[model samples]
Target chain A: MTGERTVGERTIGEQVVGEQVAGGGSGTDDFYGRLRAYEGRAAVAGGEGRDAVNEPMIRHWCEAMGDTNPAYPASAPPTMLQVWTMGGLSGHTGGSIRSEAYDELLALLDGAGCTSVVATDCEQEYLRPLRPGDRVTFDAVIESVSPRKTTKLGSGHFVTTRMDIRAGGELVGKHRFRILKYAPARRSSAAKERTTEVKEARRPRPVINRDNAGFWAGVAEHRLLIQRCTDCGTLRFPWLPGCGACGCLEWETVEASGAGTVFSYVVMHHPPFPAFDPPYAVGLIELAEGVRMISNITGVPYDKVRIGMPVELEFLRVDADLELPVFRGAVA
Target chain B: MTVRVGDELPPLRIPITRTLIVSGAIASRDYQDVHHDAEAAKEKGSPDIFMNILTTNGLVGRYITDHFGPHVRLQKVAIRLGAPNYPGDEMVLTGQVTAVTDGTAEVSVTGRNGIGNHVMGKVTLRLSLDFPHGEADSPQRGAR
Candidate 1:
């Protein structure tokens, strides 16, 4: 477990310290080789949880979550698998194993100016129930380091790690955590505006896949469309590849009659985005044809949106190039 | 509480606000920017910031366990995502007991967001053969 080791197509070192491994591509790839060296290596060991699974903490968590599951005091939420291992406000100072290779990889990134970090995504699998008095322990490994990727948050590498949570040496769950450590993306003044005009105009392009391509095409022509299973004659909204009723893969489109009612809706107020205005009514409209579709509700104030409110199909020209299907609130 | 097949669990209506999404993500130790930042989410081809699957999963777990009370042990939660739960929306969760055995039950749940069904799945839960919620926690009643 000393100097250089060869794994697959690349050569890595167990104790390479901070040696910058020259990469095969551009500046983005400059330090990838060095970062990738930490993969498959142990990053933390002998990590003891802050406290054993208990009722008080579970109650606190449940209260914060507004979860009234009467099962928590008797049994912990499977989703709280990682809470036991958290370092908390005390930080990762005690009862946890820290790996030199992992620290060095982070340091290398810090030195290269990709300092800001953000958690991207994680997947977890529960294997056993955690009850009160279960003393949790875990060990983590540097799972993988993705090559450089440029995102809206800037350019960086995605570092993923896997942790095994054990209770009394028996595996209870597994958590795969991924994070992006990178330099923040630069935004133009136009995008930094706080006015009503700019933020409402920068709508992100719709993601169109083969299954739903015709739906967007229909929108461009001022036609509200629904997918009808040719085999079963069943109607569906927001098109899908196959019919749920018959599993038929063939389908055809029928123009909507431009009628519907508000089945449900929500008004956004915080964590503002660059496109949609806050307190705007985004509704799930149950069309006259029986299939439901979601779109912005207009022709009424935000608070006026209500269930069973009449609405009609209309096209909204968000920007010079983007026209989306919207529903106009009709007279009561 | 004893549950029988066809027992309907009261639907839980959760407001799809940015705070709700962000708090849930952070509580779960998830730091993915897409869960919290909208502009960055747009860069990733999403309409706006959308709820992560984990949050939806956690909600599903809570939705079932909440109904079964605290004694039910979740054996498995298999779910598939359908639509995104964007902010400015509401998620209505509904569940029904699908099966019941000697000491366990199977419940099917569907959480519908504005876009469509945000998550749809089943939860296999285990508990004592017979018990009541108030009595189940009597052992730990005064530990507070």
Candidate 2:
């Protein structure tokens, strides 16, 4: 098969290898043409998820997002469409059905000095909810690759892959993931100097609407308010217009006693934002009234924050126009 | 419990912290370095580790269920991301019903962060409005 291919005086294999080594410049058009050829080719074929749809991952996701919807534990979250297909830290291993065309396409991009990569976005369509014990399988194709274009990061191409996720041989969902493979843009001296004059970014303002305006109003007066259903007398935090227990619309505000316990918490460490410092503790505070709210845990070091730790409500004046309700953990 | 076209669902405010970004990524089984390792992310020309699309999708799903109740079935979620959800930012998710027929509602959702719109798309969900009476506990109830 190798001997059969020929191009002019040289074999086709030799010509292909020579072209790859001669990367950009005159071959740029040919390079993109080769990339486009990968479109519709199998990226992953008959791939199996590292783990089945399970409750532990779902529970962990709910805890991280502060989502307590009971429907979980029964059925997996529809947004977890990609979770079942992930390869995890070790990445796709033995059972991986990865195709050579996909690898070759990426190598082509790498040879062109477009090494840095970042996921741009993804789209998902859930045909049905995934449940526990369902064996997940998928097959993906190289959907498309855009022409070389310069972006804020650098000059690169956008590669999109589409995957069909299935469980027990039945189609369950579809996912499309797009990424940019680019060469990092060099920073100019002027840009570096400007960055040195670092101006702190202001904290994001809270979104206050008709349903929760009264709660913020109470915070301005240094009071933590919880909404109580007028019909069922059920207490709720982060005010809602209707009662979840009884579906009552009428609600009244009650001043909280300012007492609470840390139900769960996480310490922020990476991806520093301008407004707040990192390594800070954010807690899901369960109030004495049985309602819970998310707030910053203060008056103690981040690592010191513990589950079940007692805390008191306090208003933090982040800036001139912004104030937030934070919890001050009891310092031992 | 009748969902009409043009009816806007209540907004949901989610605090974007480093913890949420990292934890959400891990929970979704996405071990991409850019979603958890700041140094690796910076090397790739990102300011820092940012939120993964799976996390954004999860948040969007949660926002919808929180409004329509836990019984709703999510049919589809198609989103395009703009600004990255960095730590210490807030993403306020707002949705409006664009079409409603045969017990299914199509909602156009937008998640805005401090920098700009983090995610914008549409969500199709089937709502069975037959929620059990007196079962209204807050969705934020501690799972412990």
Q: Return the top candidate by TM-score.
A: 2
Q: lDDT per residue, candidate 1, B109-136, as tens digits?
A: 8788776666666676776656532322
Clashing pairs in 2: A244-B136, A245-B134, A245-B135, A245-B136
In the order shown, what is each candidate's alpha-carbon RMSD? 25.1, 24.4
lDDT of 2 by residue, A1-332 (tens): 11211112211112122212224586677888899999999999989988888889889988877778899978988888888888887877685467899999999999998998767656788888899989899999999998876665667888989999999899999888888787776668534533442345578888999999999999999999899999999998778889999999999999999999999998989756656667788899999989999999989999999999999988999889999899999876
DockQ top scorer: 2
Error of 1 at B88 (Å): 6.5
lDDT for B141 (candidate 1): 30
List the per-model TM-score of the A chain.
0.49, 0.50
Model 1: residues with Cα > 4 Å off, grouped in runs: A1-30, A93-97, A189-332, B1-12, B16-57, B64-144
lDDT score for residue A254 of model 2: 92
Give the lowest summed-lDDT range of ten residues in model 1 chain B: B132-141
Give lDDT: candidate 2, residue B102: 56
